[model samples]
Target: MIKWIIFDAMGVIFIVGDDTNDLLVPFIQGHNKRILKKTINEVYLRASLGQITSRQFWQEVGLGAQYPQIETVYLDTQLILDDGFTSVARMMSKQYSLALLSNDVSEWSAYLRNRFAMDFLDVFVISGDIHCRKPDLNIYKRFLKEAGTQAGECVFIDDRCKNLAVAKSMGFKTIYFVRQPKKSDFVPDASITSFNELENAIENICQQIIERVIFY
Candidate 1:
């Protein structure tokens, strides 16, 4: 039986998952159009890997003077908590363990969690803290370790196929969360376009798993 539900941070929990792509690059370019998007992304990669502090990320982007405000103005201002997610999370948390696995700057992730009152989730495995990112099985392994659960006992939800693929390969039941309807070839054990459908999808996956166990 699935006893845990793990969510991805940026896209799945927050409205934007790839914040570097959706938030940072544009913010940097807006300030200095001469700075190539590629360069901005390179610096963001370092920040997401914990190689640089959040302050250093702003400094690297030539916004050292604005570091204090950038996270609020550039990141938090643009990112939003997905509608209905919190309500569903409240209902589901009573039934199953909840976790968030994210590829994000450590400080930013923590701040966002606090800002959005997302500390309700039982566990958070951030890439910046661990110095690794998703689509890498290592991160998933770390999540399992931190959550104290077996892969088969967890349902991992994310907006990215690559991330889901890694989790599925590691014995997790994968749920593809379609937040903005991007094209994807990877199929998941289940899919949810909105949080309203989340509980049903999770229940269906659980029923299927139970049936499989009975049949086998």
Candidate 2:
């Protein structure tokens, strides 16, 4: 039975517009712009797992070079939806322990910390402070150990399949977040496009928890 729930921040809880790509990678040639060798997925993995510094992560993508001029635009790109906060907070509070595990930049993350009273969370693991990123195994392991919860007792939800795969291998039940069909490849216990879907999933999972206890 799940007693705790963890979430990935960027795609799952917030939506960044197409301009994110432009802000992240600003260089363009006369006709074509260079593509990133390491996808955002890879960057996030490294960041969340604490494998690289924020500077190092952005430098690899050529964005670090122009960080000074574009920093504001880059940091301001993130948008936190009111509906998402209402949904996730409603389901995860009181009944279940909730944590946010995210790979994020220090400056911007601090901004969010002030904007939202995420103190409601039982725990929050952010890459910038810890110098660890996701899919590294260590971060997840540390989170579980420090969170004092067993893998089977927790559910991890992320927008990427690879991230979910890693979480599953570590014994977490995972949900892959899809923006459109609300489903993805790895058969999440539940997949949702909007935060509002979290209430139903939480209720359903808690019911299963009750059933299991009763049967046992």
Candidate 3:
């Protein structure tokens, strides 16, 4: 029986909703300014996965040009957690072995852990610490080793198609989270725009597995 549910942070747990693009659009549009450096998404990921320090990341992206004036905006823009994250996490803890598998840097993951106090999580794996990122099946294999569970017994949820495909290939039942439901998309084991929908997904997965086991 499926005994665990693994969640991806960032896109799956938090919703930024193109807010970064929202900020950059105005400046470039008004001035016809060329984007001079790495995209904010790249810089954010670099810092988030521990490839660079936050200061170095911000500076490289020209946030240092404005210095203290935009420090708050820069930091705030990168790490906005979605609403209802903690509540859903807490609720899921009651049912399955709730785990978070994130490709994040040391500092960013620390910030998120502090912000949410993820005491409810049974396994919190961060790629920065392990020096491995997902979509590389090794990371998923490592998680299986650490959790003492086989891939077939776990459900992996990620927003990235590449990552989800890897997990699915490794025998995990995969869920692709959509930011909003569309009229057409290959249905996942379940797709949820919000954390509130997670419990029902878990229950459905459990029922499906149970039926399969009975038939076998």
Candidate 4:
């Protein structure tokens, strides 16, 4: 039985702009998306893992001189809680353990916690705290250990197919959240575009699992 529901923070619980584009990309004058993406990716893991401060990260990208201004723009970036998902999470907390597993920088994560009320969450496995990001087997193992639950007893929901694929391989039921589906080798057990479909998808999965157990 699924005793826990693990949620990804960025695209799932919190809406960060219209898409997952980098917050600083647009604010940077004369920016090249390709080079910017490459540069950010190079240092993103280390920054998310809390090995360096956000200022240090921008410095590595050669934006150290404009770090303060970029930081202001980044902070001003639109980010809001998905009310529908928050409501669902609140309701689900009564029946199942609810957790947040996110890849985020330490300073921003702290800012989010202070800005939002997350009392309904039973566990929070943040990459900044653990120094490991998703799609990394170690992070998932850490979440399992912290939550005190087996992989089979959890349902993992993420907006990225790659992340879901990793969770599925680790034996956790996976759900992919996206607006328009594209072809992918990593098939999710369920795909949802809106928060409205989430509850039903989860229910259907649980029902199917129960039926299989009964049959065998």
Best candidate, TM-score: 1
Top lDDT hit:
1
- Local lDDT at 74 for model 4: 64
lDDT for model 3, please.
0.72
**lDDT per residue (tens digit) for residues 1-216 in model 1:** 889999887788777777777877887888877888898999888998999999998888888888788767865677878888899998899999999999999998888888878767999999999999988778998988888889999999999998998888889999998877777777899998888999999989999988998999
Ranking by TM-score: 1, 4, 3, 2
- Give stretches of model 3 more than 4 Å off: 17-49, 62-78, 180-187
Runs off by more than 4 Å, candidate 1: 182-184
User: Model 3: per-residue lDDT, tens digit, 1-216?
Assistant: 888889888677766434336543443233334544246667656665567775675576655666544544544555567777788778777778988888876666666676667888888888877767877777898899889999999998887767887888778988878775445433467777777787788788889988988999
Q: Candidate 2 on 35-126: residue-level lDDT in tens?
A: 45346546645654457655665665556776554445455544554456645575567788988887776655666756666776788877
Worst 10 residues of 4 by lDDT: 17-26
Q: What is the C-alpha lDDT profile of model 4 across 1-216, one tens digit per residue?
A: 989999898878776522325454454423434456556665767888989988897787677888767665565565667778777888889889998889988777667666677788888888888888888999999999999999989999998888888899989999888844667888888888778898888888899889989999
Q: Which pairs of residues clash in candidate 4, taking residues 3 or more apart in a chain or in different chains? A: none
TM-score of each: 0.95, 0.71, 0.77, 0.84
lDDT of 2 at 75: 54
Q: Which candidate would rank higher by lDDT, 2 or 4?
A: 4
lDDT of model number 1:
0.87
Q: Each model's C-alpha lDDT?
A: 0.87, 0.67, 0.72, 0.79
